[model samples]
Target: MTEAFIPIFYFSGTGNTWWVGNQIAEELQERGCQAQPISIEQVTDDEAHELIEKAAMVGIGYPIYGSDAPLIMQAFIENLPAVTGQKPMFIYVTQAAWSGDGAYFMRKLIEAKGYQIRWAVHFNMPNNINADLGWIITMILKLFQAKLPHAAERAAKLAQHIVDNQPWIMGKSSFLSFGWTQRFFFRKGFDSSHKNIWSVDAEKCTSCGRCVRLCPVDNITLVDGLPQFGDQCNICLRCYNYCPELAILAYKRPYNPQMFGTQPYQGPVSEFKPEMLIEKK
Candidate 1:
């Protein structure tokens, strides 16, 4: 047999994880491995289990949310197939900060599934669109400068880690993902309870439909010249994040206050389109 290899996968929301997923998949192909990209966004538990049942080598890619895994990716890992034997699994993470404990969290989740994790790495991308002024300004720039060189460099470096089969930090990630900081993310400030859910001023909306078009999840509907949000928000924070009128949030984006003074990841602005992960077809 050439190699019974496949990367049964993930990566959702802002496409940071998905970008890492694509870069890894491309590298695996270049090494002559048959790799596939699986999206966890619209997938069901049964579908996830079915894919795992057929694969020996697996890769689970995701963006860290609140220092833990994204709610959706964690749920998928929780429902992953109960492994019959030890399997080699690879993990990839995409994040705005240098702090995501990707492999440590992956090892915990996969041990529950009865698999042995082989290696993993963190791939830094520009911060995802957030309800921050800098993010909005940077996003508009990305529309014109999609192929930023730094993003490609980060993606390539992460891809090299996978093909070279090197250990990526072992378990240092546990200190952060399962650490005290995870508790702080839920502590009042970053949580939804503290979120400034968008409000329409009614004086300047202009029924423009820009927010609706910009929303990744279609979470908003303009009702009589104002946007309405009913509970279904990915909280990628994009609707409010990229709003042009400065009408998106009365305050600043809730998560990061120091963003104005620092570059979160080691990169420049780059656009990530969600639909590029159709490697299955």
Candidate 2:
């Protein structure tokens, strides 16, 4: 029988992971393997599970949040239908800095669903820690422009390994391992206590409602032309990074034009339209 297809199931907050998934899919197809990249937000759990069952190989990619896996990704992995046997899977993470134990957590989650992890790697993209701090991230991205191409090159190399049917293992990515630094910095800085920390300044807000539409969790609602925040935020930072008016504030901090420096992921190679991720209801 011909080899089964490789389906890459990915979750991207802005677009970094999406880019990685698309690149991998392209390389696999070029090497004569059937491949498809699927977005986790656009599919139901049953649909994702069926894709896994029918695939000869699997790939899961997502951005690292709080030095841990995104809650949405964790939920999707947990809800997967039982597999008859272990399937070869590849796990990749996108991070600005260290990914902490995120890869380890993902490996465990996938194994729990009876999948054998063939690779656990990471892609270091531009940092998007606090979208409210866009200016800082902007400066950082400038310094990283010289090094960003390295990430894309590395992704191409990994794709070749898959095309060759090579068994590879890149576990607990560098600077991403669980340690005291991750606990003190990301765990504390990104804790759930900050769920209500976001505030919108009515004076700066133009009632554009961009935050309402960009939020992945539907946590923002427009009330009387002003945006309101809810508890469903995954802290993806889309609303804060993409806001044209700079109206959204995180941690109750005042919006400072000088200090704002966020470079959210924007280089998606695929033809995927992000607006389709929005729920129609």
Candidate 3:
């Protein structure tokens, strides 16, 4: 008799973590485990609790922002109620530029809530989403300025890691340290200090409200016919990352034109993970 093992959960803004989560789930299932994929977008507290309760081996996946996981993913994990059952957990972090000790933090928080941290891994994917247009330009310039073919190299290196679980020897990519941002984010990203993290560019914005509708948490609104974001922004930056016109700035950087998907993903290996897709009996 075989046991049905379920591993589910991830937070993706601009679809990076979502992509990565699906890959990890598939890999687990390929090893003969029953893996499930769950998105943190539009996540409700009650639903999260139920999923966490049912997962035999839970996986928490998110992108690396600065030195930590996305604010939205952090909030989701913090809100989960303590489960009576014990399960082995894996913390996965998907990133393009920099990744901090995301697994380290997750293990700490989950342990506080009474759970076991079985393993952790930091994996890099392609930079599908850029920080801002200004940042896009900056990265392009840097890409050309530096003679190194960093993208191609990173992709090759990450793919090998995925297939063999080998350690990557690439240099560090994180721009800032998580220790600097941890204290404040643990409270919430919507606090006064984090308000400016997501802002609209009036000149670039056409009042489409795509950001408003696309936001899983309903954090944006229209005030005076212009999009006005409330205090609760999770800073997923999906508004800007997925915007048709690229109107949102993570801080003040312009949206990059290259954000059109040339970069190799730092998240999931592929869309469906081929192996994880569940077919009807």
Candidate 4:
């Protein structure tokens, strides 16, 4: 008999969603199912279509941006080829503070493509955006670190349920799901225009081309040994977090101040690998 294969498609900026997708993949494997975690940005449309076609189930994951789905994820969802019958699907969204309607929006997208949504889960992780909170940053890191065990366990259990074809539900918070008005406003106002907010410091940049390589959208180019931003950035902050020189700036006031540099999530998920998860008997 052919074994069931599950594919998890993730859009990660600073590796948060990648980590979550890996965790779920790990659990699915432990249950004797074949699962693979693939980064959406790393695959071409044809490759993505191939992955989806081979899978018996699908998993979609991403980090919430501007209280909604990141632009890249939206584009990926739109590009997916429709299925003949409904494919069982699950959604997982990670956010620093609030996911708003991010998971809801993604659920709708998946269902629109003839996928049956088995469940949608929201995870609150450390914010990747380097806010100038000083001492609060320490507190935030500590809190996220403390939540790792619970989050991993939740991910594993959810994946197990999917593997067993069992039903599970998460009573997500209502307050976190922002209204349509807010979603429309933020999606149009912030996410659509975020690419313009990034800037490169000519004095600080070493022309190492880290930002250029890290850009998921190919929205960066090197001109005269300095990185220049384009109009397609998804605000994933990969360049900001991965920059060794802290030269890339978001130019959004307190949200991206120069004083605070390279504030990426250093939580257990970021620090640990998926193989570290133990399959509970």
Winner by lDDT: 4
* CA-only RMSD, every prediction: 6.3, 3.6, 7.0, 5.5
Give candidate 3 misplaced runs (Cα > 4 Å).
Answer: 132-137, 140-193, 197-204, 249-253, 256-281
Model 3, C-alpha of 107: deviation from truth (Å): 2.3
lDDT of 3 by residue, 13-94 (tens): 6555666566666655665557777775545677767766766656677776655766667787787677655565666676
Question: Residue 251 of model 3: what lDDT?
Answer: 72
Q: Which ten residues in a row have the lowest lDDT in candidate 2?
A: 260-269
lDDT of prediction 3 = 0.58
Candidate 2 lDDT for residue 272: 44
TM-score of each: 0.69, 0.83, 0.68, 0.82
Stretches off by above 4 angstroms in model 2 are: 1-3, 130-146, 172-185, 254-257, 260-273, 276-281
TM-score, candidate number 1: 0.69
Q: Could you give candidate 2's per-residue lDDT for residues 35-93 as a string of tens digits?
A: 78888877887777788778888888888775676767878778876675787788888
lDDT of 4 by residue, 67-98 (tens): 57778888998898899689888888887665
How many clashing residue pairs appear in each of the predictions shown? 0, 10, 14, 0
Comparing 2 with 3 on lDDT, the higher-scoring candidate is: 2
| Model 4 RMSD, rounded to 1 decimal | 5.5
lDDT of 1 by residue, 53-94 (tens): 778577888765555565556667777787868877877766
Q: Tell me how candidate 4 scores on lDDT.
A: 0.71
